[model samples]
Target: MTRTVLVTGGSSGIGRAIAERFAADQAEVFITGRTPDTVERTAKELGVHGVACDAGDPGQVTALTARLDGLDVLVNAAGGLSQATSDDGSNLDALLAQWHAHLEQNLLTAVLTTASVQDRLTSGSSVISIGSIGAERRGGSYGAAKAALGAWNASLSAELAPKGVTCNVISAGFIDGTNFFHGQLSNERRRTLVEETHNKRSGTVDDIAQTAHFLASPGARHITGQTLHVNGGAFTTR
Candidate 1:
């Protein structure tokens, strides 16, 4: 059976890798990005449907959901460090702007998107939200938002589990070859990240991609409402 899968922020990085993984399995994949050209180019290259959308916007999310005809998998991979700025020139204003951006991009994006498409998700459906290791450490506003994502997923899973739908968060760490750092990652930082990992290597997008694929698979149906850490021992949990 061909599964209908949607991945937000799929133009590049982790989202794109997840989309490609699904596409390789012959799933009917749909990808979205904030930029039309990037979305189009990725869609063309991956041979999947593409939509330009700011997932954080309610109107845009509604519009995006209208294009879907019942979804099997929804991956909320549309989050990162916010680039929002405040022109008010005050510390409080700047702080508020930064926090808002983080919440909008990382937390609200998943919340709104999932709610808008809730009706489309049915039995055997899976909702996977991308998370961060910072949620357990000094993530500041970004971490707080990700931590909120996990909390929301817990509640979401409980609500949806009775309907045979599963929701979970994939808390990733130090993935290479992504714009998560916006080209600001220095060699020292990179080496330190690797050294902190038990495997002594930076994570690849495929690591998270494979995890997403599995969570949407039958084997993972029994595993819902859980935050699965994929940081290669950068953080541990009992």
Candidate 2:
């Protein structure tokens, strides 16, 4: 059976990898990005549908959801460290702006997108949100937002589980081949990140992509309201 999948922020990075993974399985995949050209290009390249949308915006999310009939998998992969800016250049204003951006991008994007598509999620469906290891330590505002994502997922899973829908967060660590650092990652930082991992290697987008695929599989139907860490043992839970 061909599953209908929607992946936000799928033009590149982990989202694109997940979309490609599903597309390979012959799933009907729809990918969204904030930019039209990128989304269209990636959709064409991947042989999937594409829509330009800012997932954080309620109206845009509503419009995006309208294009869907019933969804089998929804990957909320839209999130990143937002640059902080303020007109007055005041430290407090900058701080507030930074926090707001983090929450809006990393947290609210998932919340809004999921809520808008809640009714369309079929029974036995999955909601997979991309998270970060920064949520556990040294994650500042960005981490806090991801942490909030996990918390929200817990509640969301509880609510959706009774309806046969599973929701979970994938807390990823130092993945390579993505513009995650916006070209600001130094060699020293890169080495340190790999060294901190038990595997002694940076994660690949396929790592997270595989995990997302599994979570949406029949085997993972029992798994819900969980935070699955894909950081190569960078962080652990008992």
Candidate 3:
């Protein structure tokens, strides 16, 4: 039987890579993005369905969920940190605004999307949330939100495990390709990041995409509520 998959923020970056992976496997793939043009262009290029929806907004998420049914995989990949996304990040009020924006963009997006599509998921479905290594180190507001994501995933796993659904988070490291850094990464910083990794090389979007694919496969059914770190040993765990 053909599987049905949904990936949010799939117009570019890691999300796009994950969508392409699913499409290549001959699954019925659906991707969503905040912009119509990019979503349409990506859908046309990848031969998959695309919808214009801001996953961070509750109403848009509701609409997007309504369009999905019998979903086998839900990849929550819509999240990012913009320096100017909120009030100034220095002042107290600005700090509050920044924190709220990060939580809304990173945490709330996945929560709202999964809650809306809970019933539509099949028995063996998988929910993969994209996370960041910042959660384990000094990422500030974004890190805090990602840490909360891991916390939430643990609870979600408990609630879904009995129903045979697996939920997990992928804590990605300094992945090089794509528009993630938005062209602000300097050569010095790039070298510093590469040096921090044990592999002495930057990561690629396909690395995370491949891991997401494995988590959704039958072999990963026994794995739930786990945070799989993919940072090339930049940070080690006990």
Instruction: Please provide, for model 3 over 1-238, each residue's C-alpha lDDT reduced to its tens digit, 9 standing for 90 to 100.
Output: 8999999989899999999999999999999998899999999999999999988888998998888768999999999875644444558787788898889889999999999999998789999999999999888888899999999999999999899999999999999777767788999998988899999999999999999999999999999999999999998898
lDDT (Cα atoms) of all candidates against the true structure: 0.95, 0.95, 0.92
TM-score of 1: 0.97
Residue 48, model 1: Cα distance from true site in angstroms? 0.5
lDDT tens per residue, model 1, 110-148: 999999999999999999999999999989888999999
Candidate 2 Cα lDDT to native: 0.95
Better of 1 and 3 by TM-score: 1
The total of clashing pairs for model 1 equals: 0
Per-residue lDDT value at 118 in model 1: 97
Off by over 4 Å in 2: 85-90
Q: Comparing 2 and 3 by lDDT, which wins? A: 2
Weakest lDDT window of 10 consecutive positions for candidate 3 = 81-90
Assess the local accuracy of residue 60 in candidate 2 as a C-alpha lDDT between 0 and 100. Answer: 97
Stretches of candidate 1 off by over 4 Å are 85-90
Question: What tens-digit string does per-residue lDDT give for candidate 2 at 68-126?
Answer: 89999999999997767632446887888888999999999999999999999979899
